[model samples]
Target: MKQILQSLSSGITEIVEIPCPSVKSGHLLICTRSSLVSAGTERMLVEFAQANLLDKARQQPERVRLVLDKMRTDGVIPTLEAVQSKLDQPLPMGYANAGVVLDVGAGVEEFSVGDRIISNGSHAEVVCVPKNLCAKIPDPVTDEAAAFTVLGAIALQGIRLAQPTLGETFVVTGLGLIGLITVQLLQAQGCRVLGIDFDPKKLDLARKFGAQTVDLSRDEDPISAAASLSQGRGIDGVLITAATKSNEPVHQAAQMCRKRGRIVLVGVVGLELSRADFYEKELSFQVSCSYGPGRYDPAYEAEGQDYPLGFVRWTAQRNFEAVLDMLATGRLDVAPLISHRFPLEQAPAAYQLLNSSEPYLGIILEYPDPQQPNDLLNPTIQLEQEHTQTKAFPSESHTKAPIPHQPVLGFIGAGNYATRILIPAFKQTNATLKAVATTGGISGVYAGRKFGFGLATTDPDSLLNDPEINTLVIATRHDSHADYVCKALNAGKYVFVEKPLAIAPDQLDAIQSTYTSILNSGTSPLLMVGFNRRFAPQIQKIKALLANLKEAKAMIMTVNAGAIPPNHWTQDAAIGGGRIIGEACHFIDLLRFLADSPIVSVQTTSLGGVELREDKVSFTLSFADGSLGTVHYLANGHKSFPKERLEIFCAGRILQLDNFRKLKGYGFSGFNSMNLWRQDKGNTACAAAFINAIESGQAAPIPFEEFVEVTRVSFEIAEAARH
Candidate 1:
């Protein structure tokens, strides 16, 4: 499959070949027939990508602040690596597309194979999209017209906000594709419409769509022109659809509206308002989000859930259906809006044509043979010829095989986590680095070059297929951990995977089934999870100190683990296993280490639903030794506040560890002594132990049974909380 991507560093566009993505449950596999290149939206993306480092910094001061804050918390080296990795990633483009279904995933009852669908699937040849993000296309709608579904949804949403009544006067600012579409929809609602834009060509198109068009470039005073057209009463409402960095468009909308008029913004614009204009007219100002009600709601978008039509009349998907409804009848026309078309193979040229102001509107990328189209976009793609030349390390055959005395190491998923934490730590170890594989092109290439790996590939299976690579380190997303681990184990290679062995219980069972066969073999592969907190010097010292206490009856542990936003893909139950399964596992594992006993029961409570507030979760773990541990996972805390604070009560003594940096012990006399700990030493120790265990052919780093038990407890707590 081939996909289009834009390089942020260079602003260059390229179409690269990559492995076709497999369909997942509740997902639709679509072979794209046509995709619309939203000129206003895509042009802004291109310009932002092309900006220099200083210019980019000036444009996004908040992002600059975040980078500086991360440096303070995570230190300099890790922050720098994160920034580099982000820069190296190529961002995918396009959202509105018309395609035919190649196959449907499990539990997708909406469409069947060979059905035409309109979706926000990008400009890819093949796209595996969640079912909710797609809608069925009627037989009457052409591929080009069907591709406008998402854009029409945007326009429909804006119109829905204005709620223009019959005979009401409406003005649409910025006559782009969305602006023109809004003008037509408002006209269909029996509202008198006026359109404003600097582009004479787009103004002409708006006029054809039943709007009274005013060319801002030619008219010195658009406010007067609009008023004169409205017979001096002023328009009832105004929709600003222009994309600009200046707040002038918003100011125009305010000036051109009557008293108590509504001003809805459907495009990206600066919202620095002039208080007098709004105060005098008492106008209502609103920014209509992408599409409508359910656009950014994860449950509605990814989980195939829907809001009742009676209560929520117009959702993002419903907005899409409304657009198709308009097209099905003669109420709305979009065919006249399209100005240019290019085949999928000419995608690079299409971007160039769109970038250059060569008199075009609604440029569409067409696929002649709908059976086979490019599908991979964004995070996945093939390396360009130039990228292929930048060797991360010598090819497999070029590098000599590892000697018997040396431990050969192969890695999968060289993402920021691997580069910043694992690779740097491994550099300090005695293990011989052989290869690193990553789906993203630049990270694998850059890390392989910097760390002197023997090979770099976009495919993890290639690493598994290599004969000389004896060990595998998996740092990919949580959903992929089980399958990758099973493959490595079957290949007779030792395995080390990151936490939360798998996202679901069934996945864990599959991994455990493979474990038995490996154990039956004489040399069972060592399976280790990256639970580095167990190796922290302070934690080790605490365990030793607690071991000597004779009268200790119970222990309480408080973890101030911070919150993650609900929109983050990690919060999605399918992908990241939610916060409890994804992150709470670390705290649970740490508790297991401290208690030195298996957790018998777990209970959880939270203040709000999973989507609203993610920070306020409390968990209690019961150990067989009659000990109890409490974890306070609060999302609302100052960044400057210490992240992790642990307190222990045992044998009439209280011990506290503050942020893993300082520790204090209080004795019976009320005397206290404090100690500061060194950073990086714990991480270094953990990495060294992992490498040594692989080299010596010893037992797993942590007991495999204990690791599985901790995972089970973590999932159980989350499942209980969700119910």
Candidate 2:
């Protein structure tokens, strides 16, 4: 379906086509007829996007800080790639839409196919929305009126925050669509309303909505005008619904509100308040969230869960229902709000109207016939021309088809692990990425195009079964890794599988035995496990530096491998094999590499008596060389802290690696030196080593025995901790 996306780097808006999303359980599928274009919200977004890089940074200092933090964590190269991918993604637009239910997903008992529904669906021909965001339209309401339901909810929520009772006087700042709606809703509650705005035309509209208009540009003082209208006592409450960065609106609201009165902010404006005015007045201040109760609660919004009416009278959905009721009872008429309407195909033109300052209000995009043919709603058709002209790379160019060269690679998962580590590393290698597969079609396409992959597919089997693909890099979900590896092996192609080889030890064992059998039969396929720390330059340097220390007694390895949240999918024993098996294996592999000897025994302990189902395990490995290595896999560290920290002690000399960014070597008699390493570019060195191994026809980079031993010890630690 057609969706609008903002480029992360440039923040430019673009329309793109993608697969029609399926309506899952607790979701509703709507074929959009009309959708409201939010002037206040969308204008800000467009202006932000059009700003220069420096201006964008200045506009959002908090977001810039977050980006900087991520860059520090993942390093420059990976962070840049992540930002570019995000920029290339197409986000869906428009939340207030009226449409027909094409279908009802299982567990959605509220509506059926052919029923008219209103929801926060996008400006697309078809949309799959969470059921809680959708409500059935009353027979008397037109589709255009229904499309305004979400906006009405926003206005009602602001009124609810003000809590204006009968005979109370309320002031609404800003005479925009929402401001006008707020005026009418307040009037319905028998409260006298005054609207303030710079635009005379908007003031005219507010006046039509039963509000006394106060033109801020013409009035000598808006506060005095409001106070004079209220018999010099000032208004009972104030609702600031203006959209601007200026603090004037909020200051004006404080001035207009009576002593002990309430002021609710429903607009995007700077809240730089005068402390003395607020302090002396003892006035109540509040910011109303979008819609009403349960706005940000995922259970209520996504799972069709609702709070009891007796306790929580107005939910987001209930707010939507209330707006429809007002429209049906002729209490709130939105006929004057309709200033312009465009077909879905002309959405770009609609945005252009705002940019060009064409006189318009409450612009609506109409998808008259949702079944019409449109390239922006269908990716297959959008890419049809390119697919037809492009030729597939020969199989020999990919693998062992009478050619001895770098292999052509295909990646099956481009998620966080792949984007942040695997793919960035792979970019430094000689291998060519032919295709990338992902469950998110838009992300997969963006990754492939951004990273210069030949193609992208949503189907794993399509890439695996293709003859032109020789080596498969399985970075997908843990449950599917073994199957992809097995398929690649059976296809006579090499495979590189990410950590935790399999969720179950049995599955790991089966793959190991299969590879063993294949090797014995003289038709072995190369298999590499992503134990990247072993290939990290800092870790390797520590190993080489410690090789000649004869006086080194016991080696104490302290690893601050930070924690994963309890709700993370990786914490699931059935799927991710818990953190120990999935992630701690990397630390275990590093310890083995450093020890340079077989581990003789293992022991473990955890902080909390509570453990993951597989348990959040930590291990102590005793090596044959009389060196002790400890792996601490704790789940209670701050996200901003250095993620992987290692300190090694041997014969009065200590070496510490701080999150792979800096290395320090401490010797006897206060002789110590620290060297800062250049930031890691994801796992480029590891990728280069793997490609070098493929080119040289070697038995992978890491020894097979070492891999097996590490896997065995990892499983053993997990089992011990689980009990």
Q: Write the residue-wise lDDT of candidate 2 on 1-723 in tens digits.
A: 665555545656666655554556788777788899888887777776777778878988987776787677656765566665554454556788998887677898878988999998877777778888888899999999899999999999989988889999999998788998999999999999988988889988888878887887786578777888789887899998998889988787788878888999999899888997688788888999999998877668766788999999998999999999999998999989999998877787777776775677899888757444333233221122223333334334545442454577878888866765687678667776777776545556555655657666656676777676678898977767777777788777778888867767777777787787888889857888888887777777777778787643354444444555675667767667777888788888888988888988999876665645343446789988888888767666555556667888887788877777777888745435444434552267777877888888887887777877888888888878777
Task: Tell me the spans in candidate 1 whose CA falls farther than 4 Å from its real position.
Answer: 274-282, 308-313, 325-331, 340-346, 353-359, 368-493, 502-523, 535-560, 566-578, 591-632, 645-688, 712-723
| Tens-place lDDT digits, model 1, residues 480-567 | 8889989999997878888778878898888888998778776576888888887888777778777866653355555555667777
**Against the unseen true structure, what C-alpha lDDT does each candidate score?**
0.78, 0.76
Model 2 bad stretches (over 4 Å): 22-25, 65-91, 102-106, 302-305, 308-310, 368-413, 427-434, 454-529, 546-586, 596-626, 631-643, 651-653, 664-677, 688-723
Which model scores highest in lDDT?
1
TM-score list, all predictions? 0.80, 0.80
| True-vs-predicted CA distance for residue 66, candidate 1, Å | 2.5
Clashing pairs in 2: 5-91, 8-87, 612-615
